[model samples]
Target: MTTDHPRTPGPRPTGATIVWAERVTKTFTTPDGRELPVLDDIGFHLAEGEIVALLGKSGSGKSTLLRCIAGLIAPSSGTVAYRGEPLTGANPGVSMVFQSFALLPWLTVQQNVELGLHAQGVGEQERRERALKAIDLIGLDGFESAYPKELSGGMRQRVGFARALVVEPDALLMDEPFSALDVLTAENLRNELVGLWEGHEAPVKSILIVTHNIEEAVLLADRILVLAANPGRIQAELRVDLPRPRNRQDPHFESIVDTVYGILTGREDAAVAAVEPTTTGGAERPAPTPTSAPLPEVSVGGLAGLLEILVARGGEDGLAEIADELNFEIDDLLPLVDAAELLDLARTEGPRIRVTDAGREFAAADILTSKQLFAHHAASRAPLVRAIVQALAATDGHTLREGLFLDLLRRGFSAEDARRQLDIAIDWGRYAELFDYDSGDGELTLDPGAQDAL
Candidate 1:
């Protein structure tokens, strides 16, 4: 974060449990009346004054778990306790910060900070004092009267922190609060927060943050809880025992980052849980096809771009080094890597991703040739794409109603997810020239000889 204030560890934790979750499970009913499990039998605890980070991919239910702990949502089953008391509703002692700076344009910095105090039925005079105190505490003293519109993104987020602190909360919950800011700004804010926590200037005693950034978790939290997707489960708990004011280049810091990377990319159980079993002649298939899932929202051009980077790096380690070099999270990088693997352009195992022979051929080709190769692999390798083409080919008119794909998708996906998968298919199909979709009548036509778009 910032260097104006030196870093130090916060007050020593008292070993008293502040928040607890026991066998928590969250399930949602899809629009089609099917149950979709987002979280399954998760359990965790936060000690007094301890900072815990929930790290996972986008759909891993990390945010949902945070919401449950914050009492913003009721878990389908299980118990959440704060200070040995069951948290039934919005806990009065908790404050929350979010990725989006949810500030009112009409409110000035002071007024916005005072909003929470006002809701608590606090007196106007006291609200003014606490709001100003928090504003000054969070390094926003000089901008008391500035409207949200007058402040930059970083400044707006400072106001959010001030507002959350004005209540003198016992615990703070942050959901990707730093994600929207630029790199330098986010680092500065993180350091400043560490400063506050160490100095015991902030009112909150404990924090639980949701983030996908691996290094950020190591830098801020004492413990990191990695969640797995497809009915999210707690896959691993890592203790970041490194000293504070952590050096980004230190070997220990690098080691911890690497450890988390291994857990995230190499957890075989997580991979197993995400697959579906299909029977062929009464025997279940061991490996599920990647194409059965939604296609990644990456273009062939994007895949080529990443391949160029791996080639430049001489087939480097997949997650940590590349992500650090590019200032990207595993969440942002994995989709492209996964897409490449599914298309036989690259192979990733553990934390390393290497370009395959097919990948090198595609990389060496001109744009037109690349698309042709991409078209061939997409039609042959991707199960969903292959199924669509075969369906269209088998049809009398070499066409089918587009909704048929959506219906097939719904059996395995939520409505929102089904829609996303369909959109991805449409885009990839158009790029590969595998099919022509007519928006006017919602039809997909097989176009085997579709000309080169490049």
Candidate 2:
């Protein structure tokens, strides 16, 4: 049995705090005048000699919080302190490595690496020496004169690492630094970085990384902070006590990975139900309102494919095995997992997903029967789909402009997110034959039998 490493909050590392954030909340005004909270009451501290990973799904504002720590952007509330000093501008003690390999095409690797020191007005001789040292340290010794355009994606990202490390700041903040590279290349770089950190070669005092990949966090971080989405909050914090050069096949490693999966999927508590109970009491929660439960941005085909795979695997399988088989980071599978659970097609037991009887039937049925089953579940279980069906049912002539739903969604979601939700809903509705949407006219017309779904 795997030991339970549930979120144990507090400062576990012995080193003094190098970067501290307290109750940092960030909210942005949408184009439509709606207040969209990105981070909610987030608090964490990075101590000297530790690497911490901010892990979460998309929209969890992991990147936003990282930027707040780097002082690239100020939080709407709360405070960020570097070594007991409040930051009023760009953090002097932090250097950032971006996902996009933000290197100027016109500059060579050495020049790009020297940009930080140049901005700080370092003398040319010292800057050159430091830039060369950083370039060699990051395994880019011979490529100092190569432009970004002339290097492979991994090489450019190495340049990014060199540039960030060149400053030798107190904290190195990385935003999905390996996300853009190919798998093998990324693994090579990741292994090298682990080597550097474990060997005490990297100059940064503390490291903070923002990532959506659970395995990466497990493989790299001493502490992992899992953030929740839709007004991001620190849902959980876990410390990994495993030894260096962690082995993936080790039982303890697998156990910790499963524990994180359970946390991410909320399976440690209960299988996802259509309505979650409130903390006030055992009061039955209301059916999700129009914008309360955002639909997982997955297609009907993808959902059906996942169910079929689950059925083929004797009706269940570990989330980690499935992700590995498909060459997907665990995060890539979350939306489909969520969709399956939302529609009652599958349920999660810890980290394993078991197909329900309904899921088996849907996977085995013919197209028409599958559509019927999907329509039934989507209308009764999926909040957004149910709302769309209900709205069309009440409208005159069984039709309404899509803008009406978009306007309502905007109250809760950002403009881009509102559009994404509508698009996903439209796709699901059309696939289930519950409704037809004309993009040209921006109108949705309910099918004759769609009302029966309600």
Candidate 3:
């Protein structure tokens, strides 16, 4: 989308101040002539060398705001400026990393990383050097020749990061970049990223990340901008005063998480209860105020029951597979499977599925029944585990396992904890092998044994 806004001629180059969004508002006119306002009176500034996180629930216009700043979509009633000049369409100095990774499956890792540079018309040798540097920087040293399908979830994200970085963008915009990975791998990458950012001689001038995860906001953001919807607007701005390399267990960190949660849930409740009643016959009947109810308790027993059904069907299951086996429809099967998966009663591998060790224990009555045992486990432990799995999955042939670890840290993890967990998962869990970690350089990776737990 090209903009008619004239470029300001000056001796100054772009990237001097980074980004400025002033009173930006975006509205979309639907095909049926309905008008939808996505952002309202939004404003923010990203100074050079700063990382600001945009935090909100889905539909809160965080992504919309990011796109507006990127010049992917124009705002209806406000101006966005980069280094004092009004932004037009896609600026050469700005780049975005999407949540989905969006790597081309047909392309090799090197080719994918070099795409932006190629578009910018860089020479072949320069492109190769830059791409390799980005690859190495992201810890994908050897897998340049490997295809997307050969890499894992976390590794693919690195490729996405590399692609953006290779172009030497002055500002980076990420929309939930770590949301897709398992928890462990996400933490590893988060830590690694912190180190990389800290050690950089010339940093990406500014970063804007959009995320739903409250912990992520606290961990990675210098300032967290909380957005509200129903005509999206900035609700709150939180300065993360915690020191760099934040601790999740810290009281300050937990307080911020709680505050954000309260803001989201409280707003939802108020919105629901504020609906007005229809008048009839010149008399008013007050609308019923909706009451908030706590979520229903889920149990290991329930998870085991669902797992039994899945196992009975030989584990080759999709929503349809479970539905047909149990004589349930797609909707009916969702809650059961979701609850079971939440409790770790089952592990899904693409279309095929199986009961995890925890699930098996529950099914055999070796584990005690409890309300929301699975939910608690997932909240406390699953994030890290899933991250590791995703990192391993995303490696392609280029990135070593250690690079995956660093990437997770960079995404936002306690550095010491991230390293320790990787070691424990490898040594005790027998999940994978850790090749090496050099203080001067970064991590290295090696192959793991069969039957190693993930």
Candidate 4:
């Protein structure tokens, strides 16, 4: 795939600004009454004749930023403007496509596509005509009368696209619109979208897509904004200079993907340069506490699998290559990478992760030896694991209810998240043979030799 049409990267807008967000910050009140910051002073603009991707990991608040741009929600303190007009409610200039098809089950494809037009008070005849055109445009012409349940995942998503496009807004907002489909299906849709945009067939003037897939961002976006987690903020921005219909195997394309991966993994200088030295408002970040330090939700087997792969790759490989080979999104690999790093079993050098000697030995050891090695590392390195061990060790009976830990975790995480954290901790602890959990009793009991591993 290749294209003669070249797009310059960066903030150099080729057309008028369609949507702009300035210093947008969003905060949410958790069920525990804790104020959780999602977006931190985020700012960006979408201009006509461009596709921009908001790229990041799961916690980067990419969707939150997109919602704020759509005027579905107000920023905690900032402004969202559509063509110089500050938004007080839904921005009338844009329509959105969501990951979940979001089609009403009872509505026919035509009815679904006509939803926005109907809401905008379009006349019945005009709405039907336009809906038919959009349905045909999106390749669902014959399926106009088909119910959602009768459509495949791809067809269902096409209905979603038709629904958004039928509105003919100034900008199209997509929140991971292809993530729910199969790889081939997603690729097909992406290529079709690019074709529509390049051929001047798309109704909208600009497109804003939120995604966690690095290659997808490189594939379709003219500009990519890489966001960092922990109060999501823009970490780096890259302008893709490659022509449209990019080939995944192209060196330039692969290089751009690698660069973005580096920025995401904290290896690229661009990320370091974009990162603020202090917290937003110039306030210093607090030191990490046991509860505050999030555990990547990965199992012991998952972490071990990643280490084994690294070892097979001669102890290191570029993150992008690993993800591509394994048919995984970089986001899928992130938690395992995080877990390995947390346990000191792996270390990242730029865009590549290298397994530590400790990791190699653990991988090579027998089952009991592996457990002992893991226990030693878990007790010494993993904060949550160490906290659990220490708490149990200090108790006379060396047993405690799970609720005790969940309570402490709630100070940092929501109730559901707290449980997930504890569950991961329990898995790690049980695998290392450092503790035993009885689910029926909801209790964790320290194993007799737990302290010896520490």
On TM-score, the candidate that comes out on top is 2
**Superior candidate under lDDT, 1 versus 4:** 4
- By TM-score, the better pick of 3 and 4 is 4
Check candidate 2 and list the clashing pairs.
Answer: none
**Candidate 3 TM-score over all chains jointly:** 0.57
* After superposition, candidate 4 runs with Cα above 4 Å error: 1-13, 268-270, 273-292
Question: Stretches of candidate 3 above 4 Å error?
Answer: 1-16, 267-454
lDDT of 2 by residue, 122-200 (tens): 9999999999988888878788888999999999999999899888888899999999999899888888887777666
Candidate 3, residues 306-377, lDDT tens digits: the string is 777666666436644565566643334434554455445675543345777666545554332322343234
lDDT of 1 by residue, 110-173 (tens): 9999998999999999999988888888888889999999999999999999999889888889
lDDT of 4 by residue, 1-454 (tens): 1223353433324699999999999988777687777889999999998899999886689999999999999999989999999999999999999999999999999999999999999999999999988888888878889999999999999999989998998999999999999989999999988887877777789999999888899999999999987678988888898887899889988878777877876664647554445443667778555665678888888888898888888999988789889988776897888778777899887667899999999887888899999999988888898999999999999999999998887765657777998998899999999999999999999999999877
Give the whole-model CA lDDT for all candidates, comma-separated. 0.81, 0.87, 0.64, 0.87
Better of 2 and 3 by lDDT: 2
**What's the best-to-worst order under lDDT?**
2, 4, 1, 3
Candidate 3: global Cα-lDDT?
0.64
Per-residue error (Å), model 3, residue 438: 63
TM-scores for candidates 1 onward, in order: 0.87, 0.93, 0.57, 0.91
